[model samples]
Target: MPHTDTPPSGHATDLALLLTLSTLWGASYTFIRIGVETIPPLTFIAARTLIAATLLLLWMRSRNVRMPRDRRVWMRFGVQALLNSVVPFTLIAWAERSVGASLATILNSTSPVMVFVATAFITRHEPVSLRKLIGVIAGFVGTCLVIGPSALDGLGGQLVPQLAIVAATACYAGAAIYGRSFKGLHPAAPATGSLLVGALVLTPASLLVDHPWALQPSVRSLMALVALAAFSTALAFAIYFRLIQTLGAIGTTAQAYLRVPIGVAIGVVFLGESLPSSAWIGLASVVVGVAAMSMPGSAIQVRRV
Candidate 1:
């Protein structure tokens, strides 16, 4: 059914949701770091997606909304699941094995940059304004600063995992763009369907490679896994789809800028993590860049019903 109501032209509500989403997603890096210590990456992601899918399914049932029956929609869900959940979740988990939660979050902040690039170069879905272009470049430079000079020196050895994080962000960028197709669908529908597909795709791989049934995970790890699935995945996607419907891809992805600071703070407070002076400078740069990118522009107008 086509939506009858107009989407809000004002961004205040979307901004609040964006902040909440960033906080949840920011904390996810910490949970991922904790969970991966006991569970293999593939197994961990499989469980997370499955748990999220179950929760979303239950929510849908409560709302009396049926899953989409169209095969084409399901196929799109499959692709979205691969890009948005399975691939990025696995890569981030794998990267966190070597990368600190703070650093991983910082690296993951590149998603908006990738989104800008994709939108300008490939999708052409939106025009590239001078401010947005500058903002993207500034954000990338800030990201490099966040990694600091010492980390750069060791970049050669950690190149694969670092690149893996970058690749994961790229997948997120792609997923954000692809997800626009679901704008007309109920928000919960695409999130639920994508998670279901992700779970199905990874279950076999996790079972074959990790034999999760035979493994013993700690209670702490179990708690982290639950939080990762419930708060970060299920609830996060619900808000994510809503933001996408109202904010468009670039605006929604702008949350990546906020995630780094929030993630770093979570790491520092809860995990007792610390960063160098350069990282602080880089963090400020990213915040400024994101603000610049998020400034009201002609290209950012959302379509109201």
Candidate 2:
């Protein structure tokens, strides 16, 4: 499979998608924070995956697309779903129970950096230059700066949940690289197939563990759960696959860095959370790091954001 070409509009579409992805993802923390308060983590995740899978299936059917029956394809889709959705979704949900959404999101922004690091070892196609390595380290350092104060503020710090978020990001990095194989297939096909497998794998476990029927949730919580499934899981992927097709993985993953401000803004506006001075410094560092990392290898220039 060939590498996805850069978007036709050059960097403009990339920037736009970056903004959109960041905003949607940033608000995600707020939504998860609210939903988890009312619903159990596993149950909430189950509902999310199930609803998203159903939605994707219906959308595919509407387009008259046939599901691939090949065992090898199914195997690939299963692995993609486990790495891209099921595992990360469960870990993020569980971690959110213990950590703030903003902090979790900041941790999640490490995906692109992970990709840089992972590709250095695994992928022969992409070159890893010293500048790129510096950018990767800078990106990680910036992410830590953004979360540092909150993470270290109190005793009994949220070390576990923070680690969980990092782990989840790594899963995504692995998925992004692995998904390069899907370049041969239509983006929507693989995305829907993965969602289906994710739903199938999660359903039985969800029933056994969550038994959602047993717990009563308020109207708001129920709405949040539905949104998580429909918007976060389904719509987000729909756009993401399109973006991945339009822009390469590095371009798509760049959205990770942009998501921080959106998450921080959502926290401030909706949750009334305030950012400390250190967080601002962290934000600046992250922005600089991401900008440095994402610049075209030829230019190797940093522009003010």
Candidate 3:
């Protein structure tokens, strides 16, 4: 299929979608942090996927869109689940059990960098441009700045959990690239299917390990889980898969940086947190990086196999 969003207004719409995606996913860390306080990682993520899948399924039905029935498509959905939801979600949830959300956010925000590395050395999905290279570096530096110095204080430490977050980031990169194939389907198809597979994969494990029936979760944790499932996973996945088609993997993954500055700004505006002087500089860098990434010239044509 050809790229759909090519006009100037389309670019604006795509950027707005990127911002919405960033905002939804940016708040996910806090939701996960709160949900995991009482809900075990496996159960937390299993429930998240299940709830999200159900919501997406309903949305599709409302739109009269039927999911694909092919076994091959379902198989690909299984792989996507592992890359995008099952493993990464569980790893981040488990890692957050021991690490702070800020650190995890900074670490996982490297999706664009990872995608670029894969594009350079592994996937070779697109050409390596100096503009994009600079964008990746600038965005990463800005992410670090927006996250503040305190978050990096634990960089070298917490080796295991930190590695988990890095691993999750890599999975996200892989998922973004793989998601390109689903462009043939409605965005909701892959999102719902993958989450369905993820829920199926994790539900049994969650039951065996967490024995959720016996646990008493706090109301706060339950609320957090609901928000994480509905907005972060369901709504965010819809936006993500759509962008994967319109923006290509590397371009869509620019949200990895955009979210940090935006998230920090949210705190300043709504949560009464003070924005440091460095955050202003970080915001400027992030805007430049995202613009470089999403420029019409950067759109890639996939070499279909």
Best by lDDT: 3
All candidates: TM-score: 0.88, 0.83, 0.93
Best by TM-score: 3
* Regions of model 3 farther than 4 Å from truth: 1-9, 298-305
How many residue pairs clash in all the candidates, one count each?
0, 0, 0
What's the lDDT for candidate 1? Answer: 0.82
Error of 1 at 71 (Å): 1.2
Error of 3 at 227 (Å): 0.6
lDDT at 30 for candidate 2?
64
- By lDDT, the better pick of 2 and 3 is 3
Off by over 4 Å in 1: 1-9, 143-153, 271-275, 278-284, 299-305
For residue 184, give model 3's deviation from the true position in Å. 1.1
The sequence of per-residue lDDT tens digits that candidate 1 reaches over residues 1-305 is 43322245467777788889989987888788889889889999999999999999998888777787999999999999988999999999998898754456657877887888788777877656767766777776776676565645544467789889989989999999998888677788889999999999999999999999999999889999999999999999988987877777877887887776676666578869787688888888877776666666565432222
User: For model 3, where is the 10-residue window of minimal lDDT?
Assistant: 1-10
Clashing pairs in 3: none
Residue 227 displacement (Å), model 1 = 0.4
**Which of 1 and 3 is the better model by TM-score?**
3
